[model samples]
Target: MKELNSIPIENIYYMLCYSWDKLDYISRNKIGIEESMDIQNLLCRILVDEVDILIKKGIKKNYKELNESSSVVKGKINFKESIKYKSTKQCKVNHSYDELNENIIINIVIKTTLINLIKIEDLSISNRNKVKRLIKYFNFIDTILLNKKIFKNISFNKMNREYKFIINICELIFDNLLINKNDNSAEFYNFIEDERKMAYLFESFIRNFYKKELKGAKVYREDIYWELTGEFVEFLPKMQTDISLEYNDKKYLIDAKYYKKSLVENYGSKKLISGNLYQIFSYLKNNESKSKKDEFSTGILLYPRVDKTLDLEYSMDKHNINIYTVNLNSKWNEISKRLISLIK
Candidate 1:
């Protein structure tokens, strides 16, 4: 329970000792400010995250054990056992972990904690494994799925592949921060937050994933054009607004949605999206006014691929105004090949 901010200024030497303690005394004092600062920051993050995982895990574990045994005896809280507050004079680390602890972890406290983790290598691995698994599982799910609920299933091979891109970066963190075979509930809870962050980061590449690979240079206004689906004024009265586009001579009105595949089945199959149909129906009604002598004026809803549908089409307006689904999941080559098959 010592205040991290008020650590003994004398303990600064302990930090310095631990830093170069890995190296000889000559190398210790010779460390650069930048390198030392880096080590110090890394140590701080590791320390802070540790205290967070440990305290939370220990409390919950004690409670579960108490209830299971049907004992009313109160468990002792060892404040001294908790080195949540510690300080350092030297350290180094790489990427920063966003502090997801319920409490705002003090910077100094975190540094102190990391120092102790190294000092007590003989300490129980139970807490260490908890911390490591929590970090790894979270970072993994967040990298690929990025959904808050994505942690419900981690055993799938598809989800596991996402770890390959991140392994090189996380190798050091896993080794230093985790006690791998330990059971820790606090670590599990923390995984949810970690998963959310990683998944968000992974999906940030949505635009990059579907980038266009033009065969020849695309003309500024030729390959794709925003040909008005209907006169802007007339398109407005059909329970909707127009502003529809004609991409590559396809007479259609398009709306963009970033729906994942899971939502597609739940919403589209259960008949929950009747209004969506009406909205698109309006687009067709308006755009139909602009149809050429041959082709139909269609309404298209563009979305990211989920179940890998091979251009599934649903009929409306007696099969005259067709609504088609497009895939956003495959590699550019596969997608382009599928697109050729779809357009015809």
Candidate 2:
């Protein structure tokens, strides 16, 4: 069997920032995510640190279901449900209590998942300190909901706004909690082998960066409508761009492509993928009518930097298109400069 590679934990942060639309999380708390650290340890550290801070300020409190005999009752008393069965027929009025909130439910779920991961031999092979600290954090949490059910469909609002990062992290953890039949070291590796997912992350990271950092240019994901009208148009698929930039009467449609091998062999010659070129061409053709200054409208097919440097540009009657690559492995300043320079 061949050894499989794991997705870096930093990439997961990038994924989270874009998927959750939490641009500030990565920018604010940039610590604890190092490329040298194992992903499992990184996740544990995130849980511990985020939860510890909340614990210091005190756990977020909300009104939860509580039914017991109290002198004063705040919420509506469930008399029928509470008095249905009593071991002793004692004169005790049951009142629905509104004690602490269910915000700790997030902590309970995270800690339980951490416990399960600790038992797995595949993921538990490294960073003993992380394991010990996870256990301590698990023990520190007082509310222990033994149910190992993952919250797949959670709705977020202002009440739980601060816990968004924690909730999203737990979502990623739950997706990775596949049942282990035997002690296979490759299980963790196999779980993260989806290149399509990585591609989407790479695309979204670029889009969000433009939306946040671009000063004068307006950046957004543009939806290109089909030129044809009739039943065929309704049946056709949606043409959605990864990112688009518009400024000073010029518009640039950018599509981000991700792959391990940047070059594709064509007719015994190395070149960019033909299908990508076709797709970008089609997008430009269908949307040319909407451009105010078609002469300045441009299209870009962007790819992550691989082994070779491939940059090409072409200009037609009213449209200019280019194929460019960005190196994500470079320093933050360099990456930012390269992307921001696109507008110029």
**Index of the highest-TM-score prediction:** 2
Distance (Å) between predicted and true CA of 308, model 2? 0.7
**Cα lDDT tens digits for candidate 2, 1-344:** 01113445565556557656786656667565677766555665566566656656655656667667744555777677557535566555567756775446766666666565565454535444555565574564553433325475455688766677776666655555554547622223333356776677678788877777776778888788888878666789899888888867788889988776667888898877888888888788888887675335788988777665567889876778898777665565676788777667
For model 2, the local distance difference test gives 0.66
Clash pairs, candidate 2, are 62-101, 66-97
Best by lDDT: 2
Candidate 1 weakest ten by summed lDDT: 59-68
Model 1 residue 7 lDDT? 24
Roughly what TM-score does model 1 have, to 2 decimal places?
0.28
Q: In model 2, how large is the Cα lDDT of residue 305? A: 74
Off by over 4 Å in 1: 1-250, 261-269, 290-295, 308-310, 315-329
